[model samples]
Structure formats: structure tokens, C-alpha cells
Target chain A: MLTSCTNAIILTVNGDEHMLVVEPNELLINVLRNELGLTGSKYGCGTGQCGACTVLIDGEPALACVTLAVACDGKEIVTIEGIARPDGGLHPIQEEFLGENAVQCGFCTPGMILMAGDLLKRNPHPTEPEIRHHIKGNICRCTGYNGIVRAIQHAAARMAEPAAADGPDLVKEAR
Target chain B: MKLESYVRPAGLEEALAVLAAPGPKALVFAGGTDLVPMMRKMRMNGTLLNGDSPRVILDLSKLDELCGIRKAGGMLEIGAATTMGVIAADPSVKKLVPVLAAAAASVGSPLVRNRATLGGNLVTASPSADTAPALLAAGAVVRLAGAEGGPRELPLSEFFVAYRKTALQPGEIVTHVLVPLAGRPVAGRFEKVGLRNADAISVVCAACEIELEGSTCRAARIGLGAVAAVPVRALAVEAALLGREITADVAAECARLVHEHISPIDDVRASAQYRGWVAEAVVARMITDTAREAGA
Candidate 1:
């Protein structure tokens, strides 16, 4: 249990920073799930073997299990919930994931989200094999990889289209 | 371990001073994915778990002493702290050191690789360590910083004498790894035998590097992992492959030499006989793969 008696932890999540006095040995996953209540990331294996605990550390996906809360001091951490805009608009990846029905067990979704975000950041247009290979580190037991792959493609197609609004929302809101 | 006290030193010198202090128990933290769990599990070699553990936990991740990759002379000096993603994505590494790049890509997966360090791979020194054979096959060198001051260099081949053993003295720490550039990385292949397509520990792995001119082999080096107490080169295989034409018959003959040099043990991942057999096949594959590089 982290107490006020110990050192204060400073976390910059979703472009917002928070300070807390956490246990010296608290895990980043725990800090996010418990203290910050940013529980989008799931904990599958406390050991680093499983990618279920992955989160973006400085814009790169990192295993949250082995990462200590104190280690993240002065570092930026982005969780799955943080992917959406401040106005509650989903990032294209998340929207595509929902549109493609990519979520299953919901356990590995956060890790997959982080990994997919990482892939698109590095390569906007990745082949199926490349996408598979990129997310190979992430394990989804519910395993909607086919849907997940489609979601990525769907997201890519949507992103490829100009964002000037297409079908329903544009005309109705224009009035 | 329930870290008793965590101290993020202002610099490397302060960290080392804390580490070097007599009886001031400490564990260096980098990626912590391994150390933290092992400590948390109470299986850690030193330091107490969640109890009396360390007066301070030194986070080496802050130390810039071990990061990045750069062109150095004819070889590429990959900073020990450099992430696996950097290695896989680097154009120079992909073009020149494809084996290393591939091995990097093949490590635990993207998320794990992004945090795992090559220095940690060598320092941890597990027989099933995925990156060891690749480093050995590259004929890379490790630089260690010790209590004595200036850093020392050791060929990766001689670094690991046995399972979980390294030449580092009590206070020595691995600072960097120098992987030779491609086309000159000794012409090697890192073939791993594991349970899954990815994230599985190696069952029996081998990396073979050979320098062949036309039909004749010039120099040869073979590093086999998860077969013995330590990762070792199959000397008999090396001798058999060198100064000879690369052929299936010769490769078959070289493959059979596995029993003569390797000392595999039966374990959960595989049986002794199976490990030896996999070693043979892995070696054979390496020879053929190197043979295809006639144009490389």
C-alpha cells in the first residue's frame, strides 16, 4: 500500500500530470488501475512475459508489470482510455476496433490498442504480415485477430479518407 | 521485493557510489521487467524480497552511459541500453546485420523488445537467452565497467562460462555491446527451437557463422544455446565445415557431428537427444543459409 509517508509519484498521463505519494515498490499497472483509476490497461501476467499489461512509455509500448511506479517519474504514460479526444471522440483505431467488433475477452484489448497505435505511428500502411508480426507480442485469448486485423485496415481506410465528414453527421450538423 | 527504499540518484556516479557502498544492498534497475518480478517472487539471488531488501534501488535507466547505436570504424557499436525496436527498425542494422535485426524482431514480441536491452540479455546470461547465440555469432564484444575505473572489453564468446555466469567481477557492470557490421558479421544464422512462433523460450538454439570463398570455407564459428550448462561453439562442427565445400552431403556430415561436441541435457522444453538433433538441423540450416549469401 502506498502511503503519504513515502516519496511522491509524479505521472503525466494523457497529457495531464498528477502527483501522489505511492509505495516505493508499487507497480505502474497498479498505480494506473488503483491510484489514477486509469484501468484501460489489463493485467494478465504479472511477469513481463504477457503483453496484457502493456502501456505507452514515452510513446512506445512497454510492459507495465515490470515497470515500477517510481521509475515512471517525469515520464509520459498513455493508457487506452487516453486514446480518445477530450470531447469523448474515439481515436480512429478505437473506433475501428469497435466498428469491427475487435474486442472479445477485453483482457488483451489495451495491450493490442497500445501495440496497434505503435505500429501505425511507425508505419501508416503496414501489410497484414507486418501487422501480425508487430502485434505478435500482444496475446489476445479471446483472439479476434481476424477482426482486429480488419479493424486496423478499417481504421487505415478511414484515416486515408479526408476528415471533412462524410455521411450522416456532416449534413445534419451543418444545419 | 517490497523495496524498502528507492533512490533515484542524480547521476551515474552517485548511483555507483551507492552500489559500491559495503553492505548497502542494492539491485540495479533498467527495464525491471525481469529484476522486479524475480525480486517480487523472492527468487532473486541477492537482496531480500519485500523485506529488508535494499537500502536503495538504483535505477540504471536514467544512466545515459548505455544507450543508442552508432557507426564505429567498420563495426556498429550498439549501446547496451538501446531498445530492441531501435535495432529492428534501423536501416543500417536491417541491411548490414539482418541476422541481428531478425533476432531482435523475433525476441519476446514488440512490447517486450521495446523495453528489453541487449546488455540485459548478455548480462542475464540465460542458456535459453534468445539473444546470446546471435551476439556470439556476430562475434560481438562486451564492454564492462568495474570498480577499478576504466572499462574492459571481452569477446562475447568467452564471456559466459556457464549457465547464469559471466566474467564480470563483483562490482562490474555491462555498459555496451559492439555488434560487427553486416557482410562482415561473420556470415551467421540464429535458428531457435521453441514452443511457439514467438515469446517462447528456446528449446535448443544454434547460431553458425562461416566465411566461405567459392566452394571452400575459410573460417567458421558456431554457437549453440540451451544445449549445455553454457552456450558453446560446436568445435567439431566448425572444424568440419571450414575449408570444405558447402553441400548437403557435407552439411549432413556436419550435422551428425553434433553428438561429438555438444552436451545437451534433457529438460522440460526438450529431451537431450532431441536437443542434439535440433542442434544438427539448426547447424545444417545455417550452413545452407550462409551459402545463399554468395552475392551478399
Candidate 2:
């Protein structure tokens, strides 16, 4: 019979590489939150339904709550913390979320922001329905999601025109 | 959940050897979307804790043999480990088997679909599996490899033995799903009635693939899900529509015959009566939509 054995895995998170020993059953959410001190990914429903524990695994959004850490060896992961600019500034999506009052309790903010970032990356100009469709996995109990949808639209507009002085003001028009 | 060991075999041969081992309960792990949640549930119920023997997880994500979509002869052979995201986005799948692509797209959200695999969806054997109905309607075949046998293929219709049970043997693992491509153009549609638009389990789902010459149905295959012990092909409905002209009345009559093939039970998602009603509605809509797409 196979016995319990700890496996050493290397995870590159937010462009930093770290080697850690994890159990076979250790989930990626626990490894990121508890072991690596990156708690941006929240553990909502341990099941795959709620996307609160979302993170980018190899450039694709995946639920970390159900992902085994050992299964992610040598994979590049980006968390909510990594969504910020390299210069320590908030991303456009984050800026729009704050500017649009998209956040209420902030429990689902990290996941929502990460999902928006992924959406904007894939589609620079997404319609309102596309934004809603892309972030369907994430659930926010506080905000009815109108603000979230508007914030994503504002971010898309801002990202499309980086040099425009009226980029941040697009949220007002969106509202 | 406590796992004794996890092994990511380097190749298919090594994976089969590990599965053939006499000791330890080995579970095939792919995508980990279903298995991880299932293990967590078992842990919550104290089932895994009470078990005396160790459990081994055989991870197949790294096996190259089980991870691609290719065309071989007349078949579109899709690797079992191919993710739903890939399947939904693949050009060949979208162009060839559109119903499968639509079904794959209607699975969980982008995050879930990125990690959830085609094999995991079918192997989990859930009655409401989004991809099962499309695959069954497409007349797909499952290829299995075991320690003893060289390799074997089974029709998707025969793969499911019972509720949450498959025909997989002790040492067998699903390697690929081969979908026979039709020589002629076929119109297909997949409909899934979930509680919400996204990330909701299906109350009733149906897939229809119809070959039409003008308004006459040359051939038809109908698969239904979430309204049976396992995903089932609506054989009676297919037979009824074989040579009939696909009109609204014909579609409605064929839909009414779907109840004879499905035995849905009341669960948290829906009641059996609701499923029956929804099944008829969805089946009728799918048939009508597919026939219309076929220019019937």
C-alpha cells in the first residue's frame, strides 16, 4: 500500500518562485493563503461553484480551492495580488472597481477583480453582457452586480485609451 | 481529506502499471474539479477518515497520450484530459461537432471550464453532466486502456452501466473519446435549462443532431440529460423522427415520447415532474431549432 508522502513542488506566484513541500491533499488555495501568505484568494465554497478562490493558473483562470498543490508543480500562478502594476499602482480594473463603488463588503472583491483582469486581457473591448458572462462564476452577495458590470466596462474603456485625460471619467457616463 | 500518495505517471504504460498494482485503492485524477470536491465531501462525512487503507491518486494531467484533440481517419479523437475550455474554443470542434462545443461552453463558469476536463465530466457520471448528452447524441465512442487488455473501445451509449457507475474495469482508464464525423452536413443543437444562466446544474438538458433532406429527416439522434439515471439517447424520439417531416407538430410529438426513455428522480435541483415537463419542452425546442438550422 502507498504511504503518506510529502511532495516538494515549486510554484511561481506573481513572478516569484518558491519551493514548498505539500501533502497530496493540500489544495492550492490553502497553499497560497496559509503557506505562502498570499491571501488575496478567498475560500468561499470549497466546491467549484463559487469562484471566490479564483487565480490564474498558467494564464488561465482556475478555482484554487479544488486544485491540488502537487498538481500545479512548475506552473506559473497569478493571484489577486499579482494583478497590480509592477510599479505598485492599482490596475485599471481595480481603479474602476474603487471608483465605481463596485465593492461593498469586499469579500468577493479579490475574485471579482481577478476575473475582470482576465476578461480585459482577453478582450480589450467587451460589451456589458460579455463582461457579465466572463465573470459569471463569481458571486457577490452585497452588490447586486450592476456596479461590478459598470466597473468592468469602465476598465475596458480606460485600458483602451491609456493617454486620454477623460479615461477615469468614463465611469460617470457608464453610471 | 487525507490522501496517502499522489502519483503523476510519466507515460501511459507507467500509469497502467500503477493502476494494476494489487494494493491501495487507486483513483484516477484528471482536472481535479470533481474528484477534489468529492473527496472533500467524503471527508466531511467522515468516510475517508474511517477507511483503514490508504488511497492513491493517479494524476493523468501530465500524460501526453491523454491530452490532445486530433483527427484520425473519419474520427475526431479527443483526448480524455482535454479541458472544457479547450473543447469549447477549439476551431475543429466548433466547425465539426457544434453541439459538443455548445455543450462544453455551457458547463461551469470560465474558471471551472478551464480546469474541468471532458473525461472528468463524463467519468463523474452525473446525470446532469453538460457534455454527456452532446457526446451521446454525436454517437461518440470511449477508448479504454487497462493493465490486462491491449485497448478497447465502447460506444458511449454502453459506457454508462447505472447511476454514478461506469463500465470501467478495475485497472481501466478512459484514454480518449472518438467521435465519428458525418460525411454529410448535419444540423445539431444543444439546450440546457439550468436554474441560472451560468454555473447552475441543469434541470433538463437535451441535444439533437438531425440529418435532413429538405424537410424530411434522413437521420436523427437525440440525447437527454438530468432526466435519467444516466445520460441517455432518446431512441424512441429518434425513431419517431427518422423519416418524418420536421414540423412543429412532429417535433412536439417526438418530444412527448421522450418520457418513455428517461426516469428522472426528485433531487435538490428539481422534482421529477418538473424535469419531465422541462425535458419535453427542451427536446421539442432543440429539434425544432436544429431542423430549422438544417433549412427544413
Candidate 3:
């Protein structure tokens, strides 16, 4: 969908700098999946309505499907593949999602986990309603959202531990 | 759409210059939440991507000149490029004009708010634009910077021309929005009804601001969205409320008058009759809520 030559962009994905050539119409989700082979972010609606392609841009949740790759020239982005320890230990949010049976088909997990991770980082002791409010964008067609909300609450409790005080940092590894 | 080039202008002047060029079908975008999807749909329809001429995108995300919220000279000045998330969460907005914050908070969701901009919301000019009614009720003024002349200011009410239209001219960009802080005590309320709790376009939304003096209405402003061609102010209702005591009977009259003022049409989200009824009910609730909050 581009007529001109590819433009150079230096994107810090999962704490690693990758200089790639992208087109003007290329979306962030496409760049993350095709160019970088990080397919953790799913492309559900291609529109912003669905949170299937949600990712973190500067520690805030953004819909990658609507986000242009050209606009994200020098920003730090985090995908679901990056939300784990270097030693292969699962992030607390990821572990809790499993324990709460939040994964039905597992399509919306990446966005849900990242959104919950960002929420816990901002509010270490968010109430149940607050947990539901944070993941409003990420939709789960299978679990009916009860399990997802429960998983976020469980993650908040786990991340509140003194050793895991830095909730988002636990998932943010230096690759 | 097949984009031939992308330009990231460093400043407002450079951006205006890029838009003035006549080679390709150039378009300026801030968040791209709305424009990107429209273009993608155009491409899917086989209309834009395979066209003969090229399409150019002027990315305005890096233009820091149009992104922030500040208070100066007794007004809240919001940069046009400021994201909805930032505006909704800003302490000053939350404290002074909570209705605007509520409207912004009710927008799509966190991800959508993170990327959606105030300028984009206005520029798109959807009849159901979430922030339009709130800004209109607050009496906002928009600042536009163009290529030829110095910046100009226009009241937010006059900025919208028609359905999906605005008063913006070619090569002009929305720079800032000025919202006057009321010197007197005021209470505001905002309400929206959607199909679902989140991520649903508004079926009907209403916002009201009132200034009270000993249980009598000193002044009032009312705005409604999705009931007309453009988000509109309820002049008849505002006129009826002024100088009248805030009461259930007065609110009923104002709510009835709302139906007389708006021209709604049946659409996918709602029926014209449903919008008319909801407009009345929502306005009545907002008026009563704001009156109670103002102790009137």
C-alpha cells in the first residue's frame, strides 16, 4: 500500500533497538508482527474498536491497528512477547490469568495482560471495579470478562508484594 | 490508501507548508485513529489505493507545539493535539470542569483515549462526538493557525458548520482551545447513553452548566450531541431556564422544549424518535443534577 521507498525508523521494541524500513501506510501492528516477528499482538478488527492489537507506547495502552508505524518513529513499545523474565519465568499477571482461567481461546491475553500490568503499575491497590475499568478496551469473547477481572485483581495482589513492588518492571526485561 | 510519502513537520509553519502543496492528495493527521480506518476502508473498497495519484500523509504526532494543558489568564488553554486520556486525567480539568472530564472519560476506552486527540474529535465533527457537547457547554474558543495569516480565534459553537464539517479553512490547523473559567460558582453535569458500558458510540449525550443565585438561575448553557446534523446548543432550553427557579416543573418544561429544538434522524445506532426522547430525559436529568449540585 505504499508507492515510495521504505522509510527508516528506529523502534525500541521489547527493550531492544531495531532499525527497520517501513512504508508510510504501514501500521504498528504490521511492523511488530511481520518485520519483527513478534506476533503476540493479534489483529482482530483492524479498527480501534477492538483491543486485540493493543500495545504499550511510552507505558500507555495504544491500539496498534490504528497507530501508524511512521508516527511511532522513536518510541519504546512493549508487546506480549516481552512481558516475562529473561530466565523464562512468567510475569505475575500472566500467571494469574492462567490461575483465574482468564484464557479461553487465548487471543485477547496479550492485550489484557499488558493492560492489567499497566493498571497495577499505576494503582498498586486498585479495587475490583477499578480493575474492570482498566481493561475496558480489551475484549474477551469467551470468558465473559468475570475471569479476566478476577485475574487482574489476583495480579494486583501478587505485584503488591515488597519484592515485586515494581509491577510493570517485573514484566519489562532488558533484552 | 496507498501512501506515497510521509512528512513529519518540525513546527506549525512547516506543517502548513506541507498541506499547501498540490502534487498529491495530502492530508494532515494527529492521532490517525479516525483517518487511518477511513483510509483502510477506502482501500478495501478499491477506490483509493489503486488510484493514479499518490497520497501523502503529514504526521503531526511529533509537533510538540500543539500538545499540553495549561491555565493562563483565567482560562484553561488546551492544545488541540493533546490526547483525550491526558485531558480526562488532568487535575485541573477534573477539578474545574468535571463534565468535560467525564465526557472524555466516556470516549472509546483507554487505548482509544491514549491515541485520540481533541483536535481530531473536533475535526472529524461527528454528530455524536463525545467532547463536542461538553466543550460547547463550557463556552470554548478555538485557535487556528494558517499559512497566510496570524492565528485567529473562534467560539466553539461557531466552529462547526454542518454534519461532518467545521469552519477550518485550507492549510489551517487547530492550535489551541480556550475554555473560560467561571468567576462565579458554577455546577456542570454530563450524561451519555450508549449501547454498552464501554467502546460504544453515543446514542445521545447532553451537558449542562448553570450559575445559580439563591435558588434562581442566573445563567445556563446546554448542549446536546447525536440529535442533530451537528452537535448543537439548546438555545430554547437555555432561554427558558434563565431567570427561572430550578424545580421539577421548570425542568419538565425545558425537557419538553428540547424536542422542539433538535432535528434528529434515524440512524444505525438509534431511531429519530428514540433520540428525541432520550435528549429530553437526559437534559432534564443533567439540569436537575447540576441544579442540586449548585444548591439551587
The best-first sequence of candidates by lDDT reads 2, 3, 1
Provide the DockQ value for model 3: 0.48
TM-score for all models, in order of appearance: 0.90, 0.94, 0.94
- Stretches > 4 Å off in candidate 2: A1-4, A162-175, B44-54
Off by over 4 Å in 1: A1-6, A164-175, B9-12, B43-55, B73-75, B180-186
Question: How would you encode candidate 1's per-residue C-alpha lDDT over B1-296 as one tens digit per residue?
Answer: 34566777665566656667787566666767567776676545445432435645766765666777788876788877677777878887776666677677767777778788777777777787777777777778888876568888899988997678889776677877887664664566778789888687898877777787876888777777888877776778888877888887788798788777678888888899888888888888788877666522
lDDT tens digits, residue span B163-263, model 2: 88889888899999999985533689999998889898999988989998878998899999999999999999999998899998899998899999999
DockQ preference between candidates 2 and 3, better one: 2
Worst 10 residues of 2 chain B by lDDT: B45-54
Model 3 chain A poorest ten-residue lDDT run: A166-175
lDDT of 3 by residue, A16-121 (tens): 9999888788899999999999999999988888799999998788999999887788899999988887777788888877777788898898998998988988
Ranking by TM-score: 2, 3, 1
What do the candidate models score in CA lDDT, each in turn? 0.76, 0.87, 0.85
Where does candidate 1 clash, by residue pair? Answer: A2-A23, B1-B39, B1-B40, B1-B50, B2-B50, B96-B182
Give fnat, all candidates. 0.61, 0.66, 0.66
